[model samples]
Target chain A: MNRRDGDTCSSTPDDSLAREERRLGWTLVAPALGVVLLVAIAPLAWTVWESFHHHDLRMPWLGRSFVGLANYRELLGTPRFWASLAHTAFFAVASVSLELILGLVLALAMQRASRGRALIRATVLVPWALPTVVAALLWRFLFQSDAGVVNAVLIAAGVLDQPVVWLAGTVTAWVPVILADVWKTTPFVALLLLAGLQGIDPTLHESAAIDGAGRWRVLTRITLPLLRPAILVALVFRTLDAIRVFDLIYVLTGGGPGTATEPVALYTFSALMQNLRFGYGAALSVTIFAVAFLLAVIYVRLLGADDGRGGSTT
Target chain B: MDSLAAACRASFLLLVLGACGGGRADPRPVVTISGSAVGDEGAILRRQMDRFMELHPAVRVELRQTPDDASQRHQLYVQWLVARAEDPDVLQLDVVWTPEFAAAGWLSPLDRFAPEAAAFFPATIEANRWDGSLYAMPWFVDVGLLYRRTDLVPEAPVSLEMLPALARAAMAGAGAPGGPPPPAAGWVWQGARYEGLVTVYLEILTAHGGRIMDDSGRVVVDDPPGVDALTFMRDAIRRGVSPREVLTWHEEETRFAFQNGDAVFMRNWPYAAALLADSVRSQVAGRVGVSTIPAARGSGGRPASALGGAQLAINAHSDVPDLAWLLVSFLTAPEQMLERAEAVGQLPPRPALYDDARLAAALPLGVRVAREAVASAVPRPVTPLWSELSERLQIALHSALAGQVEPGPALHTAAADMNALLERSGLRYGMNAP
Candidate 1:
């Protein structure tokens, strides 16, 4: 903002032109700002107010009285809350990191493919195009112990003597969940990184090859350096989504076989919808938002450092 | 010009007042009735509503189909009721939701309506009452009954202790000369982590002579029979009488497995009977039989079943309470109930319907068995914090069934949690309370 101010002051001889430019910019952004205030900020403020009160839909006669930090204190102290937080963190990190590596491979494939490029791209995007709920349901059917084709194929191929209840085990439940999420979202990350791959100059690869650089060396020093920004953007999008994961796990596990695979968002939903404890659920929502905000800030800082190292490429 | 502008403003104000008065003057009130109508049930309900509308043309009844899933429907109702919206004048309530809805002051007491409950099954009517006032009218009734293949078992097991040995023997006889192939599963029921698990557990617990909430509404499940009930379920899985997949089974899963002839026995509601008997959809159409859930060894009482059904209640905020009551009463009338029973296999709440000649001719065995099951049906704990208590119980029963917690500890923990919830809400009104 300071650099922009100095440039405007030096380039314009008259102050009125710069002032008019500023007014025009504000006018252009006014609609977007109004939308953000109405849809995001207003609800966030209401949630904040609600988090400090005693509110249960089924117990309306108790009245919506101020309860201070009681809800927060109870949530923080609960073992289930901490367990859910751990599950959410593991889900986010595992899904994002796995998607990043797989997505990068797909992005490279898309960049190098010389035939049927459109077909390959479209086929890769099919999973992403399907709705999350529908994809989750499909995966649920595939993982069922008795009727699902997964166990049927495995047993037929001598992979197992008996069918395994994939959703009943604490560790095994997460395997299907993570795999389903990766299958659905890796294409999205690939699309973002594919756009970044196109922005790189062909001369960089040509020059690296002329210098006798090997294929792997060229990839590490040149392709990866240019891809940092895209990777960061993809990471932010996927991480935020993974942290707020609810629908997939809700459909697949219903947080069960003993609440082993329950994520924090499902916990929040149980409090809100099932238990009707709005104040506690609001506090949970605020905590989740705060966590996402912290992760975004850290990623943005890393992005800035990456920019300084490579300078602007696009 | 000034007078003309003043005249326009005055006329606009008068028009607004006149519009408000005109709305109040309309006599034909619309009472919106909300409930779930899954599959062909919607068509039957529409026909029933058509008849209702013909009789009372002065009142227009708008029928709305809610989500098929019970939990989703409950959530939608909570959202509407908490906001105090009056659009849904009549609500279709689950039998278990009576205490919770009544305590919230969201449902209008129906004693003033003078709707008779004498013809209805006593247990169904008892479930509708809260604090000596009827908050809902029982529409249809359901009870958990053991469905088995008559070809395999030949006769229902007389006691719970005999089930495992009987199932094992039948499975062994699958390849016997002139015998049908044995199913992969011996027994299956709802065991996933939800309210359905609680109902299933309550049936088994009560059948074993365990009382969750005593007659005075006290917490009483932390006892020997409670532990024994949980152990019996765990043993079923461990002993291979019920497949391990039963842990993940809900109503639909169990129904699918049983109706497909892939299981020897199933514990499900009466709705499964008609579906299983449909020759087009099921392989066990002529072979399946409904029997009461088996009693525990040496228990003198009849085998217990959990009451499962939807009821009709008037929303307290309804603008036309009289019309809502009329719709509720009309929908639950014996004629309509019998029509639904013949059309969709819904069991009527009225016990006299079992003796109705048409119903007996259509499905004689089902009516007789359902009547017996309803007579022994035990209602779960009735409390304002029913949803909360039911959730804790689901966790308790599920954890024990999953081998994550011991039965004794699980039941004790659930009882403690329920007591804490009740005490926190200042609803301590039982002998067990301090």
Candidate 2:
């Protein structure tokens, strides 16, 4: 960065500036490392350590006794934990699958609509831009059994003879949460895909059209392949988010009607906050961090390892 | 390598904290008391603190505004007490938590602070005493009471059997006048699967010859009477007396329901009456009246109400011990009892405060209904595991309210889980063993 340091820092010029620059190189990266150490490494270590200890919320400040793998044993043994894991899996997988397909379709439709794409794009972001709690409350009101508009509309149309407890019963509760999540986040995916779509050259599409490459073939061979990186990015972003979902589930269902919609976040929260089992909660937290961390590493490696030269057609 | 550095850092922090602690020889000593910032709290806090300051020239009472929900406030207090923060010297404890908090050694035992604790109401005093030590002083008394429209519903709901039919007829148009009845009203209360639901249920359960746990800690409520109590709750909704949607309601939602003039009757605490009255924001302003949950015939017991108020305790770590005790005394004494009660619609913790005619008028039913409720109130179990018990009760009540399982099975399941928790906590009772 110094004037005398220039490009030959391995053998610096005999100037004070070059010597100072060489001395400051490591110092420049120190702040970033300090931040990472404080925020991530320390807490991550504490969480891992706490997972092996017996801690409860009532005596939150006391020294935790190391209990080896007992907390993890209990977590794995819990029917509640397994059921919640299944519920979270279903939520993330089903919701993300739907969003990806819908987002891709929307991006394709908007790609060629050259007129007013900006306005249309802005309109799509409205759902994504809403605060989560506000979105949840709006959905909860509309989905209420008695006063909710969805039930009222359904009942009026005779689709339901009796009012269904949208947020009450377990099987029925996830529908609204999934619907809310998909509605709020799919536009985000669409916008990303739309950007990717815009980045693709127009002449290739025009040539494909002139050569009688049909719409499906052009999409399959050219657009979809080229958009793979964008799709992977969106998937990575959303999957991580959907795994740790708390606010919506807490506000809407509160992990209720017999723990049907309970996810790991709600599970760990009850352990920590409600049950006052801080050590056990720590175990759950560590487990989730490990699983999610593993998933992130897997995706980054799998996707990053693939060459940018992926399949595409003109 | 890091251990020596960490020790240095710790000593440095201690020196900094110690120096800061010493520099504060300020004449004004601050004492914090937790109270809701609702109703007339703004005026009442100013007047009471002014009196407190005048009485003790060195003391300054800082009112820590607590949320209306006692449970949430209890949570905050738990965090403070666990961390042993010096501020918030006076803890306003939920009546049930007084025992649990006392047992945990978080509160300064009050015999050392106020030796005149014997003058407190027997029940209120008993509630504050844990293992022969009074760890807290009473701030106010609260009991869950039934609120009904006086003009429309019958003046006295004599028995539990008559309430559903009466609520329905009045709501469905059978010459009910004061209650929000006749096609416009709904029956409202805490129906969400939480502590409130269990509290409401216990009010009816005890009235119906039911018991949750026997003197020995054995499960006693898994019988016909318990089912009847739960069935009555269901009947209220199925019979169109209370709305089915009440299952999702908490205090605020129910308050909104009754205050907005949509409910014929609401079961709540004494604080609700003040809110209903000239918050003429409240629709059923003049129509509301407080009474006991209806008693059941041949139930062996009188109507039961759940105790739901706070007690002031000195945080054991507080440096201004005398100031904290003085603040508690000033707030709960007979002279300022009305000021505190009228400031907020809390029932006076001191039974003697009920004797004041002026104070009685401000609270309306403070002297009468509250006194009756206090006379036969039930406190939640005083075990250290009360937190766990409360959570289990919420789940059981939720299951019952959602129609997931019949009430009897749910209570049985809850009792089993509770027994396990109690066993886990190393609490042994002779009679609790089958």
Chain A accuracy as TM-score for every candidate: 0.92, 0.88
**For model 1, which pairs clash?**
none
Q: Which numbered prediction scores highest in lDDT against the true structure? A: 1
Candidate 2 lDDT over B30-104, as tens digits, reads: 887665544466577677788778878877776665545555556667777778888678877777787667656
Q: A38-136, model 2: which lDDT tens digit per residue?
A: 999999898888889887644433446789999999889876789888888888998899999999998888886879988998998999999886688
Model 1 CAPRI rating:
acceptable
Candidate 2 Cα lDDT to native: 0.76
Model 2 interface DockQ: 0.20
Candidate 2 local Cα displacement, residue A36, angstroms: 2.1
